[model samples]
Target: MRDLYEVLQIGREASAEEIKKAYRKLARRFHPDVNPHDPEAERKFREIQEAYAVLSDDDKRSQYDRFGTVDEGESAARQAHARWAGGRSRVNVSFGGFGGFPDLGDLFGDLFRGGGPVSQAPETPAEAAVELDFVDAMRGTAVVVALRREVECEACRGSGHTSEKVCGRCRGSGRLIHTDRVRVRIPAGVADGDRVRAAVRTTPGGEVAVAVKVRPHPFFERRGDDIHTTVPISFAEAYLGAEIEVGTIWGPVRAKIPPGTQSGQRFRLRGKGVRSVRTGIPGDHFYAVQIAVPRVVTPGGRDLVRRVGELYGVDPRSGLPLGLT
Candidate 1:
């Protein structure tokens, strides 16, 4: 794995603004929508997001700086505990160190041996992340996710015994490391940050949690049920109303642009957006109409545009407040 700073293309001393700017630039360039069909681009994009997630947070960044990796604190703490338990404490440590201090090693011996925690505090299930394409997320799809989890021993069925005898395979321990490949069904209209729980006997005491990450669409964005996009039209097309084909998740549909439509004007197509998961009622598809002016116009075209401007003779921004910069 690449270092977080290297993944984000920033120096260790980079400012927060610089880090954010780098992330945005990289995200835009390598976004799946921008580089479709390129697995390398998609991988880089995921890496960029991961880097930003760590560097964007103060606590995570500090942890990363102190340790080589973000999740090393727990392992480090355990190692320190082992050293103290052996009476070879290189670093000063104290956690209810009164008499002879509880034997953290023996207390957590079960945890180290995969026997599971002894505390009443519910064990936190191991978490894994799965990424899905934008379309796959919109239309429900099944994906196979591989996870390493703690599971009940098959021979003992988590009872640690069989016929009043300790199971030889598990040696009376009902839990063991299990690598599970599970097919998860993603629901339609599932947005980013959504989690789909798949119950598995990974741990004898707990389950493994999987987080779903949806890749961002190139041209479309969803808000609630509405799908938004920006479609550019020629100057003449904006002046003279025309029916233009707009792309939607289902397919392409024709949308009519009214005459004299201004730049930045938004048009809505009813019932053309995403379908609601609850009521099944589809939302509206909204497209902002942006006028595309020709950079290099012919002499005749320039003359015609000048004439049209003179004929209209109206300042569109006349209603603006006075002394506006």
Candidate 2:
């Protein structure tokens, strides 16, 4: 048999949550209903089931890890039968008749006495991608997503059989494919590549995982929780100081540009950035000041510019390094 960790495609030190996650992913891909009549998929699905059964239980996993097998004394057939029975009930097989052979009818009857074999397939979460506007990503919004997921068959109540017969509705798989339009609420300050989980009504504890893709804003950029933007200001505003309206994720707010502010100088507006989704605390917004030069088309305007230029006591580029060290 393949290593259980290899069967689940996880590392040896994988946690219980990781084991469950890997099982759900592989089970969904190789489920009998998903790949009908495919012998390879069926074999792999059974392998995944076996791997999960042992590793999911802490005691069994510890035993397997220490001894390299669960219950080394038991024969393979008995171990397999025990696993299939799930320790719910026990049957005594008597080889009293027919040349000392066990009665097939009695064994089969006891195995399928209740509702046939329990489905080992895990409930897989549905996945969908949602694209959000930049502003919506910052402020949060609800979106309707189309998803397809597997839900238990109501006819058999998740058992493959009903009244000692296979359920026709689910073809004995005990599950049905369902497509639904679900509304998912994305929390504030969700970043690109983040996944948001939403509950599904049909399946208890089932979730729809939506992958977020935030559209790029033309002027604003996000770094962590902080928002960065370049705000253009008149040259006079930078030199003489002025209060201007600045745009933020929340809205426009008044910000002051200090006197003698140079181009590319950054200013911060405290608590004006995107709110942290996990902490609920707003971040600071940082905007770089870009000096916008006005065109001097008139002779009077040129004269005014020259008069302003004369106000500079030293050359702006005097301190700049002109040679490589």
Q: Show how many residue pairs clash in every candidate, following the order shown.
A: 3, 0
Residues 126-213 of candidate 2 have per-residue lDDT tens digits of 6678889988998789999987678899999999789999999998999998878999898878765456667666544366666677
Could you give candidate 1's per-residue lDDT for residues 1-325 as a string of tens digits? Answer: 5788998888999988899778765654455543445688767876776677677778877888888677853344344335435552421222212122222222222322233444464555455567888898889788777777677899889888899999887888888776778766766865554445444565434444445667889998875466888999998889899999999887999889988998999989899887855346787888999998889889999899888887576796687988857
- Which number leads on TM-score? 2
Give the runs in model 1 whose Cα sits over 4 Å from its true position. 1-126, 151-176, 201-209, 322-325
Off by over 4 Å in 2: 1-124, 150-177, 201-205
All candidates: TM-score: 0.53, 0.54
Each model's lDDT comes to: 0.67, 0.71
Residue pairs clashing, model 2: none
Query: How many collisions between residues are there in candidate 1?
Result: 3
Model 2, position 210, has a per-residue lDDT of 68
